[model samples]
Target: MTSSTPLRIGVMGAHSTGKSLLMRRIEMELHGQGIPVARTGNLGRRAALVPLPKMQHHTLASTTWVIATGIADEIAAWARLEKGPVQVVLADRACWDALAYFRAALEWRQQTAPRAEREALHQLAHAHGRTYDLLLATVLDPDVPVESKHDYDPRYRTLVDRHTHDFLREENIRHVRVTSDPASQELAIEHALQLCMTEAPA
Candidate 1:
C-alpha cells in the first residue's frame, strides 16, 4: 500500500435511497471549493452490461465483479491525480453494497452462500473499506414513496437495507447514517464538505 491516497467518500444503501443525490450534493460542494472530484457510479448497470446477474438474481460471480470493479474505479479516480489534480473521489455504491444485495437475494430464495465464499468476500469488502476517508449509508424508510417507474420489490429492498447495516456492524466499520429527513441529508453533505476541505492536498 502507498503511504498516501486520495480522499474518498463512499455512499451505500438499497435501491431507491438517495445515494446518488447525496453524492451529487457533495460533488457540487467540492467543486465550489475548487477541488477536482471524480465520482464512480452505476455499477449495477455496468455489471448488467457484462451480462452478470444483478438485483434479485445476484450471484457470487456478479457480486465479486461489482466489488472488484468498484475498487478499481476508485483507484482509477485517484490515479487521475497523476494526470491532473483530482483530489476527492465519490463512490455512489461502496464495495460492500453488492454483498448486501447478494446476501439478501439468497435469503429471499431461502438459500445460504457457502461459509467460505461469504467470508472471503466479506474480507475483501472490509479491507477496501479501510481506505475510505468517509462513508455515508442511507437508511431505508418504507413510507417514503419511490418513483412510479421503478418496479422495486418492497421485501427485497428492505432485506438489502437490513443487510447493509448488518455488514457495517459485523465489520465494525464507522460511518454516518443518513435518513430521508432533510436534516440528516444536510448533515451528511456538511460532513463530506468538511472532510474534503480539511483533508484535500495543500
Candidate 2:
C-alpha cells in the first residue's frame, strides 16, 4: 500500500473540542493495527509559536512562520518522506485551523497593526486554506470548559466552520464531522482510512 502522494489528515476544531483526544485515539488505533502513523499537535499555550509533541517525531516549525508564509511548506516537507505507501500524517493544527485562527485574530490585530501587515495576514490565511487536504471537524459538547478565554469565542468558531466548509466544498476535499463521542470517532477514523487507502495511488 505505497502511495504516490502522502496521506495527510487534519484533526481540527476550537479549543477543548477534543481534537487532541481524537488524534491520540486515531494514532493508537492505527498503530495497534500495524499501520504507519505519525501524530502531532500544538503543545504550547501560545498560538503564535506552538511545537508538536515529542511522541509524533515530527519537527514542526513555529506557527509564526506559518502565519507569515502563506504556504505550509513545513508540513509539506514531512509529507514527502514516505518510505512506503499509506503513511498517515495527522496534525492537530493544519492549514485549515491556521486560517481560521488567523481570520479571528485579524480583527484584534487590525486595531493595532499597520494596514500592510493586516493585508498580508489575510493573504496568508487564504493560502493556508488552499494547501490542506482533508479537514476533520469536531463538534463540541456544551458541557466542556474553554481551554483559554482567547480561544473561546463562539462567533469565531462558527465563522471558522463556515469558512472551512466553503474551502472543502470548493476544493472537493473530503470533509467529515465527528461529534464528541467515541463511537463517532471510530466511524470517522474508519472512513478516513478508507479514503486514504482507496484513493488513486495517493
Candidate 3:
C-alpha cells in the first residue's frame, strides 16, 4: 500500500508453457536490455498447500487460499521495492493465473462451483488483478509436447491448459497470447520483455 503500485506484468499459462522459463529470463532481459525492473521468483508451483483435486470437499477453500497467497506474495514483493530504485515488478504468476488453474481443478473434480460461490471468489481475484498492467499468456505448443511434471498428469495438464486459455478470453482480461515455438525459449522471453516495456514506468 503506497502512492503507486509497482508496474506489474504477470506471466500466465499451463504447467509446461514456459511460465517459469520466462520468469527466470525476465530479470536478465530487462537488465541486459538496460531496462531497470525488479522481479519476483515463481511461487505458482510452491504456493499450493491443499491442491485442487486433493481438497475435494473444500475446493472453494483451497481455491481461495491459493489465489490469496499468490496476490499476497505479489504485494509483498512490491512492498519490498518501496525504498529501492526499482519501479516495475515482473511477476511469473499471479492471482489471475491462479484463477485459471482453479477453474481447471473444478472441472477435474467433475463438479461445477456454484455460480454464487464462483462469482464471489473470482470477483476477489479480479480485484487483485487490477494491480497488474500486463498479462502475457503462453500457450502449449502441439509440436513441443507437454513437459512432464510429477504433480501434473498429461491429461490434467491438457485440461488446465484448455481452461487457462478459455478463462482469459471469457473474462475479457487484456492479454497477449505468446506461442512457444519449436526452436527456443528465448523468443518467449524477448516477446514478454517487449510487452512489459510497453507501459513500464522504469
- Which candidate ranks first by TM-score, i.e. highest? 1
Better of 1 and 3 by lDDT: 1
Considering every candidate listed, which one attains the maximal lDDT? 1
Model 1 TM-score, all chains together: 0.95
Clashing pairs in model 1, backbone N/Cα/C closer than 3 A: none
* lDDT of each residue in 1-202, candidate 2, tens digit only: 2334456677665556778877787777767766666665643344334533211111123334544332344355346545544466676666556544444444433434456754564566556554445668877566655656553456655555555455556656567888878788889878766765565242
Residue-level lDDT for 166 in candidate 1: 97
Which lDDT values do the candidates have, in the order given? 0.89, 0.57, 0.69
Q: Kindly list the per-residue Cα lDDT of model 3 for residues 68-93, writing each as its tens digit.
A: 77777777776774565555677777
Model 1 agreement with the true structure over 111-140: per-residue lDDT tens digits: 988999998888888789788889999999
User: Which should have the higher lDDT, number 1 or number 2?
Assistant: 1
- Check candidate 3 and list the clashing pairs: none
Kindly report which residue stretches of model 2 are placed more than 4 angstroms away from their true locations once superposed: 1-3, 43-86, 107-133, 146-174, 197-202
Predictions ranked by TM-score, top down?
Answer: 1, 3, 2
Go through the candidates in order and give the clash count of each. 0, 2, 0
